[model samples]
Target: MSRNLDLDLIRTFVAVADSGSMTVAANLLHMTQGAVSQQVKRLEDVLDCLLFVRKTRKLELSREGEAFLVKARQLLRLNDEIWADMTGQPLRGALRVGVPYDLVTRLAPAMKAFAEAHPHVDISLVCAASPELSDAVDSGHVDVSLLEYVASEAAGEVVGIEPLVWVNGRGSDAWRKRPLPLSMVDEHCAFRQVVLGALADKGIAWRTVFESGNIEATAATVRAGLAITAWLASTVPVGVEMLTPEATGLPALPAFAICLRFPATVQPAAQEFARYARESMANEPGTRRAQLANIA
Candidate 1:
């Protein structure tokens, strides 16, 4: 119950454990690597144990750290429950949520409906890339998140998976003859590697006409006929035509997973809200229409 063992240190500990590196953990926590390391060192000093061992290229958790992870997560969960109860209103604590821009279009109506149903529960949504979203959930900045991840031991339940397609501007038929200029998100994106690997296997020539971490920018470049881009078929922007192999001669890419994860501290209301959101998306129409009405 000491102030030194507060939730901030616990969160830093969790982020370091999950990311296995101080730098990546820093990016996830929105802090500097030195700050994160200093905090971790401070926590270790208070606990009187080293939580991690610095390996050649990785941060390996000590046995003590491994053992502490379970309890640490539980402590974080209990903290959230306490905050929810002591706020003096019925389930009136904030629910931090992490979601992608495309997924948000689909989640809006469901969240609105949930807000209407539970007026007391405050919700805070942090829009970010899939990597950041997953890291935020792992760090306990958010109780639950929707992320784009492949099947892994770390991944949780699958919310949805959509096939990817090459899309180009409506009037640009340049891709109809040969491999084309490509606009894409940065290497940190889960789908970026998938698309590049597919093109590599097919011996398709491509140049990086534009690269950005922002999905909106990539979509805009694709719309402007600047370059060809790959995106989830369901989330493809309007006014872009899907290029076909027969018509544009590009091989098809496989679908990617969109996963949902819950932090160890997720409450009953958050759980209920996640369920309602999923159910709402199940019945909604395609992403294009859902986005236009802002009711996804």
Candidate 2:
């Protein structure tokens, strides 16, 4: 006999995987923590495998669980699309979304969900620096923009808050150099100015050894132990580990608001995209997704 995977169980698993804590996932899912734990257990039993390895502070995916996550996401996406098709009028249109290069991957879940739900809507993703994205939003070239901005400077709805963090290769001592070596994006990157200002205010000497528009290049430099880099905590790549400010003697960096921007007269498709993006990104740790009012 074949067993079908329960999407509810899979959703709970994905929520826990994203937040790393059942309590946070519970809050996001509006379920009790114990209930969330039970669902995970039930899923594991159904699969006849352990899905998570519980650490002292968080739940991590075992190798088997990690493999299942991708399939789980696909199943949910298809399910969501089918449900949307059955329940609502399919809106036909196109949407251009502006996103920072570092955030493109972060937008994947929202993008896929949105695309699946609105199959008739075409989406064009414009990857650029935050500042450029801001310009695109202002000029009306982009229908919606996800931005990284100083809290006080955010002109759009603040959807989430993400603290900046220092990251280097696992076990790399590159941060110990007197004049710290650095890998970063160019002036167009929104983080460049904020990160440099923090270091300067700390009276720390630093030098930029690598600078490019490619985020992967910067991540590779840090992963190779050639230099250290800073990024929003959630967007840090896999090979690098975030260094504790206290342990590394690095200055604490400021948090940036993840803002959503679009003109007041945007199309129904744009508004629809915003709603999906907001809901999808809400569960991320430190984000205030629950507090956002419905987009006007």
Candidate 3:
């Protein structure tokens, strides 16, 4: 006979892994620390293995636990998707969301699914660079904002990570120039400073060949073999080819994070959207973990 695994236990385990602290997980789950511990212990007992390494204050998943996490997230995503489809809680309100251009496509499916589920709710998407998105969040202009940052500096609930890579038009050797031609969307583009800093550290000479607030213009320039550009690997334009470190001899770029931010007082719709965002990104390639995206 097969015994069913409890979703509650799997959820608790994932929260602990995402948080790296039972205390933080407890807060996110709105449970007492001891209660969270009991849930974790119960799950481990059922599985017959230690799920966490408790040798230090900093919590880590055991090897078996790591393998279990991927499946757990998939389970939770399916559950949540089904729950939303069934109109759980039936939320109805207006929600404004700030999204960086890079994540606009990735975020679309969740938004569509949510809108279909809650026809009464209104969602307005504000497309902007990450900096502007943060300002929107701080000013309460948007109920939720998705921002990108150098992974080390990312704040709030980080849902996804992808490499920052150099790209050139197909068959273009634009990156080989003595003073490389770079295409940038704007000064405020999330990749700006880190990309420059990476090149500087390698002593690579570079000059801007194109700069625009419109990404289409920047992509057009790069696609025409006019310049090389840096992008999150997943978001690189179709006509460009990723310039590998081995091929370009350029310094390796740091990975960037897709993070969710909300005002201190989060709207209910914002919380729901955050959950869908986290689930959607978890299903995407290169995201580190499945998360709850709790507004902390």
The lDDT of each candidate is 0.73, 0.78, 0.80
Candidate 2 global CA lDDT score: 0.78
Over 166-185, each residue of candidate 3 has an lDDT whose tens digit, in order, gives 88899987889879899998
lDDT of 1 by residue, 37-87 (tens): 999998899889999999999898899998887787677757766775687
At residue 131, candidate 2 shows an lDDT of 86
Candidate number of the best lDDT: 3
Tens-digit per-residue lDDT, 191-281, candidate 2? 8888888889888899988999898888889999999998877787788888877888888877778887763234567767877788766
How far off is residue 16 in model 1, in Å? 15
Poorly placed runs, candidate 2 (over 4 Å): 1-89, 285-296
Total colliding residue pairs, candidate 2: 0
Q: Score residue 121 of candidate 3 by CA lDDT.
A: 91
Winner on lDDT between 2 and 3 is 3
TM-score to native of every candidate shown: 0.63, 0.65, 0.66
